[model samples]
Target: MSRRQRAASLAQGLLVGMTLGYTAYRAVTLAVNARRFPRLDRPHAPLRQRPRVSLLTPARDEAHNVPKLLQGLLSQGADEVILLDDNSSDGTGDLARDLCRGVPGARVISGAPLPDGWSGKNWACQQLSQAASGEVLIFVDADVEWHAGALDAVLAELERSGADLLSCWPRQDVGSAGERLITPYIDLYLLTLLPYPAMRLPLVATATAVGQVMVFRRSSYDAVGGHQLVQGDVLEDVLFAKRLKARGYRVLGALGGERIGVRMYQDYASSVNGYAKSWLPVHGNSRLLLSVALAGQFCVYTLPWMLDFPGARLLRVTGLLERSAVAWTAGRRRPADLAEGLLGPIGPLLQLPVYHKAIRRKVKWKGRVYEQ
Candidate 1:
C-alpha cells in the first residue's frame, strides 16, 4: 500500500484500540458501581425512635403536578410538610392550600418576591429551610413520585449510614419518544463514569447530587448555610453537595431503586429546553471544554455505526455491551435495557441541540432567564 494509505490504516487501528480500551474500562466501572452504589429500595422495619422530619416542596406553575406529591407526602408521615408557592402564574398556591386544608402539620407558604442574585429554586428552598422545625429536612420536587415506604427507605438509609446528606437519584420514567431518546444518556453519564462508592471520603471534586429527592440532617443544612450559599446557582444541588464535602461533612448518593421516580418533561420541546438550562453550567460554562466533550461523545457512541470499514461491527457490539451495562446499573428492565442500549447512537446525535442551546450561555426555565 502507498504511504498515505498505510498511515490512514495505522490511525484507524489506534482509534479502534482506544475505543475498545475505554469501553472495557467503562463496563467494569459500571459493574462495580452497580453493586457498590447505595440504594433506597430495601423495606425498613418500624424504627424504635423516629426523628422529627420536615418535607419541603418548592412549586412554581406546577399546579398539575403538586397534587400527587402532596397526597404522597401525607401518607409518608413526616412531622411537617411545607410547600412554597413561588409566585406561580397558575393557581399553584391555591391548589396546594385546598389540598392541605384541615391536614395537621401540612401548610402552604407564599414565596416572597425574587430578589437580585437569587435563583428561583434556591430562594424558595431558603424560605422553606427557615420555616422548617424538624430534626431532618427532606426536599422533594413537585413532580416526583414515590412508592409506598419510600420515605421509610430514605430515613432508614440515612440512619444506617450515619451520613449527613443522602441524595437519592430518582429513576426516570420516560413516556415520550423524545424522553426515551435522551434520558438514558443522563443515566449513563452518572452510573457509568462516577465512582459513587468513593463518596464516603471527603472528595469535593467528585460531589454530585440530584435535587429531586434529598435528605439532610437539619444541623448539616444549617452548617452549610442551606441554599443561601448556592444562591443564583443553576446547578444548586451539585454545588451544595461540594460545599458539604468541603466542610468535613458527608454526602452519600443512593439510587431510587423503584422507590422514587420522576418524569422531568413531557415532550420534545420541554425535554430539550429543560436540559439546556443547566448543561453549560454543569460543564463549568466553558464552551470549548463542552464542545470537545460533545465531539468525544459523538466519536464514542456514533462513529462506529457511521464507519463502514471492516471491524466497525465489533465496535458497535462492544458499544452495546457498555451501554447495556449502564442501563442495567440504572435498574432498567430487560426489554428497556436492550432497546435503549441499541438506540445508543441516536442519543449522542440528539444531544447536539441541547449542547448548542446551552453554549449560547443563556437559558430560560419556568419563565425566568439565567446566564450559564
Candidate 2:
C-alpha cells in the first residue's frame, strides 16, 4: 500500500481502537456498579399518607394495547388512571371510555384539538396534566404494562431519593429480527451518553427518561411548565428531563430491567421509521451533526471487523474485549454462557440508513405529519 493510504488506514484503526477502549471502560464500570448497589424493588412506605396520584396515558389509535395497559394500571394501588384520547379513529377512545366506566377512579377525557406547531402527544399530555388533581403525576404510555408493585415501588423510590422526577428504562421486548437489531442499540446509545454509574452520582448533570414510564411531582411538572415546555418537541421525554435539570430538580433514572417492560414497535418498518422520526430532532435539528453522527455510528459498530480481516485477530480481540467490558460495566445482567458482543458489530448498520431516510422524509406519527 502507498504511504498516504497506509497512514489513512492507521488513523482509522487508531480511532476504532480509541472508541472500543472507551466502550469497554464504560461497560466494566456499569457492571461493577450494578453489583455494588442493592436492587430498588424492595417495599417502602410512601412519603406521605394517601398521596393522590394521577396516572395519565396519551393515546392515538392505540386500541389494541390500551385494554391491557388499563388492566395493569387498575391492578396497581394508585388513586386514579386518566386516559387522554387524542382523536383516534381506531376505537381507542371508545375502549378508553369503556375502561373508565368499568373501573373505579378511572376517567377518560377528549384531548383538545391539536394546535399548529405542537406535537400531538405533548399536547395531549399537557391537557391531562391540567385536568389531573394529584400530588404526583405519572405519565405512562398505552403500550406499557406495569407489574402490581410498579407504582408503589416507583413512588417509594422517588420519595426516598427526594427526586422531583423519576423515569425507568423498562425492559424492551424485541420479538422480530428487526427489533433484535435495532432495540439493543437504543440502550447502547443511552448508556454511551448517560452512563449508569454517572446516574448514581451527582457529578454529571446529564440524564435520560423513557417516555414509556415517567413520574413527576405535581410541583416539579408545573415549575418546568409541564408539557407546554416541550410542545413541539418530537423527543419530548428528553427535553422534559432537560427542563427538570435546568430548574435545579434532581431527576432519578434506573434500569427497570425485569421490573418494567414495553413492546415499542410491531415491525421493522415501524421500528426504523420511529427512530428516523426523532433521532435527528433529539440532536436539535442539525442535519450536519446528524450526518456526522450516522457516519460515526457505523464506523464504531463495523470497523473492528474490517481491520481484523486477513490478520491475527488482534483487532477482533480488541473489539470483543471492548464489548464485554461495556456490557459488564453497564451492570445489566446477562447469562454467562451467552454471546451478545457480536450484536453490536452490525447493530448500527441497521439504524444508520434508516436515520438517513428519516432525515429526508416526513414522519407520520399519532395521525400527524411532521416534515424533516
Candidate 3:
C-alpha cells in the first residue's frame, strides 16, 4: 500500500480503538450504577404526618394536557391543587376550573401578565408559590401524569432522603416514530455521563434536576427565593438545583419508575424545538465548546457503524446493550426503545439541527416566541 493510504488507515484505526475504550468504560459504569439509581416504587415509611402538600402546575395553552394532569392531581389527595393559567389563548383555565370546581382545596388561579425580566413559566410558578398554603410544595408540569399512590410515595422519599429538594425524572413515554427517535435520548444522555453518587454531595457542578416533578420543603424554598431566584434561566430545574447546592442545602435525584410518566414532546418536530431551547445554554453557548462536545459524542457513538473493522462491530453491539440497559431503568421497553438501542448513531445526528437553533436562540413554544 502507498504511504498516504497506510497513514489514513492508521488514523481511522486509532479513532475506532479510542471509541471502543470509552464505550467499554461507559458500559461498566452503567452496570455498576444500574440498580443504584433510586426507584420510588418500593415501600417506605410515610411522612410523619400530613404535611399539607401542594401541587402547583404552570401551564400555557395546555388544553390537551389539563384533563389527565388535573385528574391525577385531584386523586393524589394534595392539600391544594393550584394551576396557574399563564395567559393561554386556549380555554385551559375554564377546563381546569370546571375540573377543580366543588373540589375543596383545588382551584385555578389566573396568572398575572408576564414581567419583563422573567420567563413565562417562572413567573407563573412564582405566583403559584405565593398562593400556596402547604408546608410542602411540588411544582409539576402540565405534561406529567401521576400514577396511583404517587403522592404517598413522593412524601415517603422526601422524608427518607432528608433532602430539601427531591427531583424526580419521570418515565419518558414515546409513541410516534419521531417520538421514539428522540425521547429516549434524555435518559441515555444523563445516566451515562452524570455521576449519580456525587449528586448527593453539596457540589454545584454535579447538581442536576428534572423539571417535570420537583418536591421542595417550603422552608427551603423560601430560604433560597424559589423560582424567583432562577426566573431567567432557560434550564431552570438544573439551575435551581445548583443554587441549592451552592447554599449548602441537600438535593437528591431519583427515578420515577412506575410512579409518574411524561411525554414532553408529541412528535419529532416538537421534540426539536423543545430540546433546542436549552441545550446550547447547557454548554454555555460557546460554539467552540459545543462543537467539541458534539464531536466527542459523534466519535464515540455515531462513527462506529460507518466503519468496517472488528473493534467497530464490537463497540456497536456493546453500545446497544448499554443503551438498552439505561433505557430499562427509565421504564422504557417498547419496540421503539429497542430500535433506539440498535440505532444508537441516530441520536447525535438528530441533535444537530436542534443545536443549530439553540445557538441562534430562536425558539417558539405554546404560541410564544423567545429569542433569549
TM-score, prediction 1: 0.93
Tens digit per residue, CA lDDT, model 1, 1-372: 999999999998887787777776777778788888877785656666789999999999999898888888888878999999999999999999999999999999999999999999999999999999999999999988877788888888888878888899887777777677776667787787677776777679877888898899999899878999899899998888888889888888888878887878887778888888888878887899889889777777789899866556876886667667676677676676557767767667788889989998578899999977
Worst 10 residues of 2 by lDDT: 329-338
Question: Alpha-carbon error at 68 in model 2, in Å?
Answer: 1.3
TM-score of each: 0.93, 0.86, 0.93
**1-372, model 2: which lDDT tens digit per residue?**
999999998986687577666656655655554554223455467657557998999999999899788888888868888998888999998887887796778989998889998889899899999999989999988888787677777777777777787887665655666555565556555555554555545433575677878888899889878898888888888878777776678877755554566778887777877787887777678888888777776555566576553332544564455444444434434643124566656656767667776677577776688876
Q: Which scores better on lDDT, 1 or 2?
A: 1
lDDT digits (tens) for residues 331-362 of candidate 3: 77775676577767666787788777777856
The whole-model C-alpha lDDT of candidate 3 against the native structure comes to 0.83
Q: In model 1, which range of ten residues has the least summed lDDT?
A: 329-338
